[model samples]
Target: MALAQRRPPGLKAVVNVAGGLISAIAWRRAWMRSSRPSRHWPWKDTLPQLWVYAGNDDLFPPSLVDGMRAAALDRGGDVRLIALPDVSPRGHAILQNGRARFVWLREMDTSLRA
Candidate 1:
């Protein structure tokens, strides 16, 4: 509600507020429904064991990844964050373009084998 007031008047703002409200309501409903089940989400009881592979130029800020890492640590979960320097969100594509697809394939193969 506060967010809706801050936006300038336009179709985009109206759409955004409407979308946000709808999404919020839907998410609340889903969360309530899911919680009623006997089964628990693993992450709730035990911290998620997260393997975060993020690029510097991801659409989301790096702080988001850092926040996840912090939250995992707070919950006593193992968090492995691999940072690829000089990499963008499209870094893999760049690697492929540079004919480093074989390297990527090898890494994937090793990971799968492990």
Candidate 2:
């Protein structure tokens, strides 16, 4: 008679599962503010921000990101809204590969140094 044995998933599988769960929770928390109409965050002008959005991003469309960038600028904040060309629709996936990723890293380095 032959018997079948089952083994637990490896360390990488465990980490990936844990990371996905954590990411989902974090995304939910961050997006919760979108449902409230009366809530407004008082942004400081001292803090600089780099808003990276894609034209094909269904989540945060170009128009919405533009408005956000305009709002930040109106508040005298240092903000750069980089609209990538022909990028992934995932939006966040823009940083996963290509020249845009390197550009983002360079910008971050410069921002941190200044």
Candidate 3:
């Protein structure tokens, strides 16, 4: 999201994995919007963006993911959210999970190609 927000020249697509504005602690405390929306979260529709979340993520759970998706859409940001199956030991590490790499890669490829 940080990279995407920079709006570098020729930026086409963005893929965010296990990323969200609110931290785990803040989310647990029922304070998802405890502070101003970070500069990282979606603010505008500069490009196509994909959000990938692990179904079993302990930190950013489904509720948080849904809230984020909703907020992005509300803000007129072009984004899509893809929730994958539980990814081993820690869903948050899906990027490092060899077995799950293919899944996210394939999804990104198809979405980007569209």
Candidate 4:
């Protein structure tokens, strides 16, 4: 599956909006400094999972994904990285094209039969 890439303009606007929202909600009591919250791991350590990341994602920089891969490797977990060359985050739209959709379906069919 192709990674969902956010356009540059869309990415910038989303970041700005998120920052503004965070600032506006900063005064809420739920985020007060006195709150002691328990931390929990959502996934079991034994589960086999694949982490798919894009190298040219505008929302998430390549360095962040590289760091995640390094951390996962350190923990002895299997990490599969899929990097597309000369592609922007907006390239995800290609998946929506009829030809691309047909190719994706064919790949899925082959995988399932195997």
Candidate 2 lDDT by residue in tens digits, 1-114: 000011223311110100112233333444455653112223424345555655766555565455544544665656655567646536546756576677666765665566
Which residue pairs does candidate 2 place in steric collision? Answer: none
Clashes of each: 0, 0, 0, 1
For candidate 4, the per-residue lDDT at 64 reads: 43
Instruction: Please write out the lDDT profile of model 3 over residues 1-114, one tens digit for every residue.
Output: 666667889888888888755443453344354453333344566477888999889878787777666656656777788888899989998888887889888988888997
Assess candidate 1 and give its TM-score to the true structure: 0.36
What stretches of model 1 exceed 4 Å from their correct place? 1-42, 45-50, 88-114
lDDT of each: 0.35, 0.45, 0.73, 0.33
**At residue 47, what lDDT does model 1 achieve?**
19
Better of 1 and 2 by TM-score: 2
Supply candidate 1's per-residue lDDT for 81: 45
Structural similarity to truth (TM-score) of each candidate: 0.36, 0.53, 0.75, 0.38
Model 4 Cα displacement at 91 (Å)?
5.7
Writing each residue's lDDT as its tens digit, candidate 1 over 23-83 gives 3333344434673321221232131222323254343234444544454355444444444
Model 3, residue 43: C-alpha shift (Å) = 1.5
Candidate of highest lDDT:
3
Arranged by TM-score, best first: 3, 2, 4, 1
Clashes of 4: 1
- Worst lDDT run of 10 residues, candidate 4, spans 12-21
Q: CA shift at 6, candidate 3, in angstroms?
A: 2.2
Model 4 quality (TM-score): 0.38
Residues 1-114 of candidate 4: C-alpha lDDT, one tens digit per residue: 111122333221111100111222232232233232111111112223333333344443455445434544555444444433324324334343454445445544543354
